[model samples]
Target chain A: MLKEILYYTWGAVVSFVLAFSVGITYMGLNRKVTARVQNRIGPPWYQNFLDVIKLGSKKTAIHHGVMHHLGPAFLMVSSVMSLLIIPILNNGRFYPNLNFHGDLIFLLYIMTFGPLGMALGAGQTGNPNSAIGVTRGLAQMAGFEIPWVMALVALMIQYKTTSIVDLMNIQAETGRWLMFSSPFAFIAAIMAMFGMFRYSPFDIVGAPSELASGPMSENGGKYLFTMMSSGSVFAFAKLTLYTDLFLGGADNLLVLVLKTFVLYMIPVLYGVVNPRYRTEQAVRWFWGWPSFFGLLAILQASFF
Target chain B: MINDKESQKIVDIIQNFARKHSLWVLAYGTGCGAIEIPPTMTSRYDAERLGVRGAATPRQADVLLITGYLTTKTLKRVIRVYEQMQDPKYVIGFGSCTINGGMYFDSYNTIKALDRYLPVDVYINGCMPRPEAVLKGFAKLQELIQAGKADGSKKYKENLEWYRANQKEVIPVWRMPEFNW
Candidate 1:
């Protein structure tokens, strides 16, 4: 039992490290890419690393209350938990610990954990902007989750299994990834991901101009550092989950990185070129076409 | 076989390097000089190349750029912001107004010398420093930070009493919270 616990703890650590490094690196690249797109020189690839370290190395930190302190911790837990549950490689031998059957439903619940924790923390700060940002974030989350859940339902129904490992196995056996098989679900989920990534058009929650970074307005020093790192880890978890669910599960680390990076670019590129929508407009956008595509995916799964 | 002093020095060097590279400026536009910030941030100057980005709040920001002349009213808010920021923070007295109130030097309500109330790490002496001069000021701050010369936060902590007296004198209706470093 002790051995099993130790192994599980070790596995969790490895997964956390992997998600954090990849996610932060992608964020740095996103900045560089955005800068280049605007015809300007950008910070180096290690810029995010420096920012994280500097924030962490701050000599002082402030908290509104216990919840404020617990907020980032909760966010960290959710991301780490999600990362642990998601399978990175198709081969079972290397990462066999957490890829259990009947985990799709659990994954869905855990995915919402970070935002809720963040909301609680933001609420504790007594900042009106943070409150407004939280409300918008939760609303946007509700908007996107409908289509996202529908897509997940369609996938589970089509595959006749809730285990991510089984879904990945089915792809390997049929030699056709779900992205091609259920193109409608892929489209729906990808659209939902635009909001999930919190880029342009859907970044109303943290509208830096209007909301002053929303939920994180009061967080500074080590608190902000924790939020930043947790955000990166959560980003990786979501990307890996999508890569596993829609794209075929990767067989090797390099393939996984490439697939995740390509998937990561979709929302980022869209964000760069678009203007933000108001809260209601974003909700309307998500519920409109994305929901329709999700329904179509469900229909496709049910029929021929 | 490194001694304790040597290891501490190495860590300090690393921290300084990281701090120098990443300077998150709080987006608090106090005066007309705020106009120059957009050009500095956007493609024309591209402050991101120097690892300088605009932070939305005092807590997350490392540098407080007092853009121009500070009215007595605005000085209260600026002091509040400077206090809320975490340790190792720096303030740049941007534009002539921030240095000596520039065009507003004789204005009764405006504070003439920013350094009297808060520690000024770098002073850019233009009526309104252009984006180029602003970037140069940032570069200077970064150099000060890397060389372990930027101790503005420390100075503020040490002279909190005197600074508060100055602040209280300016804003007689002083309702600002007691700064605890």
Candidate 2:
């Protein structure tokens, strides 16, 4: 029993480390890609590592209250929790920590836990910008989550199961990725992803020009460092979740990285050329077409 | 076996190296010198290649870029912003206005010297420094950071009384929070 517990603990740590590094690298690559698109040579891919380290080494951090201190901690908790539950590889020796049946529904709820925790922290700061940003973030989350949940519900009804592992296993057995099998659900989820990633056209929550980075205006030093790492971890877990659900979960680490990177580019590339949307427009956007596709996915799942 | 002092030095080296590479400049567009920043940040002169990026707020910023001249009115806010910044912060006084008030030299309102009000690590000396000059100023700041010479925050803490005296002379009505570093 002790050895099993130790092994699970070790696996969780390794998975966290892997997810963080991959997520940070993807963010760095996003910067590089943005730079190249704009006819400029960007910073190196390892720039974020230097940034996180510098933030960690900073001498002072100010907090308004206990919630402010716990905001990033809350974000980290949600991120690690999601990483542990999301299976990293299909048949790997090291990954898929703490995953269980009916985890898909649990995953969806847990993913939003961090942001709400952060909102509580942001509210405690008494910064009006942080308040506005948190509202915008939550509103946008409400907007995107409809289609995102619809997509998941469609999959659940179609498969008659809530386990992500079961979904991957079904895909493996049929030798068909769900992206082709459930095209509307994929389309809806992809649209929702634009908001999920918080890119342009939906990036009002942290709109630097208008809101001074919105929810994160007061966070600095160690708080910012923790937030950054958690953001990366969360990003990786979300991407991995998408890959497992639609792209047929990876058989190995290299495949996992490749598939996740390809999945990651959808939002990053879309964010590059597009301009931002106001809060209402962003919320309305998700309600319009993505939600339409989501309905179609549900209809298709039930009848056909 | 390394001695404690040597081990400390090694850690400092690594810390300084990271600090030198990642500079999140607070976009405090104080004066006409702010015009030059857009060009410096955008495609023609991308500062990100040097790991210089704009930070949204003073709390998250490492470098405070004071663009253009400081009027007695704006100085209070500038001082507040500077204090809000965490430790190991830097100040880059941009343009000739920051150096000696430039065109505002004879103006009654503008402070002629920026150093009196705030500790400046680097000064880009031109009436309006071009993007090239701005990047050069950043490079110089990076060099200073690596050498452990850019200690403006330290200087501010050490001579808080004197700095407060200077700040009080211009502002007159000082109703600010007690700056506890």
Best model number under DockQ: 2
Candidate 2, DockQ score (0 to 1): 0.88
Ten contiguous residues minimizing lDDT sum, candidate 1 chain A: A91-100
- First chain of candidate 2, TM-score: 0.99
Residues A1-304 of candidate 2 have per-residue lDDT tens digits of: 9989998898999999998999999999999999999999999999999999899999999999999999999999999999999998885545438889999999999999999999999999999999999999999999999999999999999999999999999999999999999999999999999998997878899999899999899999999999999999999999999999999988888998999999899999999999999899999999999999999999999999
Q: Mind giving the per-residue lDDT tens digits that candidate 1 earns over A254-283?
A: 988999999999998988888889999999
lDDT of 2 by residue, B34-135 (tens): 999988999999999999999999999999999998889999999999999998999999999999889999999999999998999999999889999999
**Model 2 reproduced share of reference interface contacts:** 0.88
Q: Which residue pairs come into collision in candidate 1?
A: none
TM-score of each: 0.97, 0.98
Model 2: lDDT of residue B91:
97
Regions of model 2 farther than 4 Å from truth: B1-3
**Candidate closest to the true structure, highest TM-score:** 2
- Tens-digit lDDT string for candidate 1 (B69-176): 899998888888988999889999888887777898789999999999999999998976788899899999999999999999898888889998998899989876
- The CA lDDT of each predicted structure is 0.90, 0.93
DockQ of each: 0.86, 0.88
Alpha-carbon shift of residue B2 in model 1 (angstroms): 12
